[model samples]
Target: MAHDALRDELATLTTEAADAALDDIDLVPTLEAARRMNAADRSVPAAIEPCLPAVAEAADRIAAAFARGGRLVYVGAGTPGRLGVLDASECPPTFGTDPSQVVGVIAGGDVALTTAVEGAEDDEAAAVHDLDALGLTADDVVVGISASGRTPYVLAAIREARRRSATTVSVACNAGSAAGRLADIAIDVVVGPEFIAGSTRLKAGTAQKLVCNMLTTLAMVRRHKTYGNRMVDVRATNEKLVARAFSLVQDVTGAPDAEVSAALEACDGEVKTAIAMLLTGVSADVARSRLAEADGSLRAVL
Candidate 1:
């Protein structure tokens, strides 16, 4: 009976449906198979186009929460869980956000990220425990991701988030998913069936990745994490990043390389401060003060 119930839920999800067109994919030439796969991948973007309005709304909600000193949390299982973790982990280096500002909670904890924990996705109680550990609040935004839209762990997390009055957004590859029903905003990409039947790590994963990108990237933009298209808040932690920081400062200020280097050094390699100092001919201390006054908006400072 338990197996029957789970099978029924999966039956209703388009992500689990088999594609007859690719039935003989394994028998095809390597190049032909690759071409077919690439062709199918192209449809993911189109599937997400209609959901942009919902994605925008969710991003706005998240940005508002950030302004109010809130955090963004993603919860999921399997491939969706890894995607959430990837996005959350990237916030710091890409946008210079605090690690705590964005976080990912996967079923079975960090151990589930690499090695699949047996039955982890079915552990609803564990989901509740994980969300509780975060101390979810009304100011936080919780995004629940599941390719099937019915992962038990993800549904439980969304329910717990709702109970805490946190904003809940669901990303599902199927329309009218269980997770979607529980969220305040539902982003259903509905990318049809996958080439490899139930292997959602393909098309469904691609759709989820695109949606996650828009949510965090747009939220950061709203928070003044960039100066125009340039990622001015990027953390210059390595040699390549350090060079990119210098390049960004020079590009934005159009200052000589020597002046850019001097400003970056004076500002301790803070890209935004270096840009501000060069553009305004101010001392590093003055540039830092102006940035703080403008709420860290380089545009506003200039």
Candidate 2:
């Protein structure tokens, strides 16, 4: 696209529009300026409310993919890309999922996470190359995230994902965006203009963060990673998490501390297994077999 055409396209984005009310923002008192910014930030959730159905639908698809041993992949640029990576990185530690189960593909690669890669988002072919590296298959779900919803890199990745028979979802901050038009499920947060003109790193970034959180967290829940709101699949790899695992086992089993500690030791610090053993007063081996039979669902085993 020519510079003028690109500029005109950006001009049409809600995120790029300058809020007239903020024209006098520089002239305001410090507290007043802060209040104005806070007010703008506070409207983000409501803006996202209308997009919940789409987010939920995409999450359902993601969960189904997980059940089939498939993955949920995020593709994006700039702040949106960073948010996707942040969310993807948390899944394994939080839900005990393999790193391959949830993945993030950012434009400009690892270098883009901290430094701006000039013209990276405009490289359509780069997006295809990144997704292709993942060996994407029909069971996978690729979510393209872009604040403007017109990012060529994100659009290309989504298009490529669909071409490979993978499910595609889009998260953008505009109505009827190109990314949305191409995706099976489109989530438009529509958070309105940024406090500073065209600076999508602000409210638009927050909206994408919120949606990513919802998507991945709920997908994990649907995959039986949680047991009645408790993170049963937690990997107790740290002191804090080990403590949490003990507490979880105790809470679920309501067993004496000695028995809980013994069960945990027998289960190799696996909280769900410990809980199953104590609650059912069964051997650790029996608990393990029951959990496996129940598809790792603690509630189902109980």
Candidate 3:
């Protein structure tokens, strides 16, 4: 894109506009500046409220894809790209999903996560290459995240994803986004101008993170990754999480510490199986069979 054309495009986006109200932000005291930024951040959730239905719909589509042995792939640039990676990385430890189950692709690849890659977001062909490397399939769901909704890389990624018959979702902080038009599901949270003009890493970044949280969290919940409010599928990889698992098992079964420890050991520290064994007085093998029969839903088995 030419500089003139790009400038014209940016002029039309609400997110790119400068807020005259914040022109004096730098002149204010440090505390006042922080307050102003916090106040700006607080509006992000309300802006997203109107987009919940769209978010829920996208999440359900993601859950359906997962059930079909598909994956949830997030594609974006810059801060949005980093947010996608962060969300995808948390899935394994949080919900016991394979690393391949949730994927994140940035315009410039892994190196971009730490350092900026100049003009990478404008290379639309790179976006197609990244998705192709994933062996894009019809069963997968791809989400394009771009604050301006006009990002060339994200637009290309969404288009490529749709071309492959994969479910496509667009998440942006602007109305009438190009990405939104290309996606099957459009989630646009129009939060207006940012605290710092044209810097989307602030309000836009926060909003994207929150939206991604809902997408991944609810999708896992729908797939029986949790047993009610507890993370029954949590991978106890560390001391804190192992502790959490023990407390979670005991809390759900009302079992004594010794009994919970025994059940956990018997079930190989699998929270759902341990809870099942303790609550029903069943052996670990029987509990595992029951859980499998119940489609991994503890509530159903109970």
lDDT of each: 0.94, 0.92, 0.94
RMSD of 2: 1.2
Model 3 regions lying over 4 Å from their true place: none
Off by over 4 Å in 2: none
TM-score of each: 0.98, 0.97, 0.98
Q: Which residue pairs come into collision in candidate 3?
A: none
* lDDT (Cα) of model 3: 0.94
Name model 1 segments beyond 4 Å from true.
none
Candidate 2 displacement at residue 173 in angstroms: 0.1
Give the alpha carbon lDDT tens digit for every residue of 93-123 in model 1.
9999999999999998899899999999999
Candidate 2 per-residue C-alpha lDDT over 253-294 given as tens digits, one digit per residue, 9 for 90 to 100: 788889888998998988888888888889989998999898
lDDT of 3 by residue, 175-251 (tens): 87888988999999998899999899989999999999999999999999998778999999999999999999988
Least accurate 10 contiguous residues by lDDT in model 3: 1-10
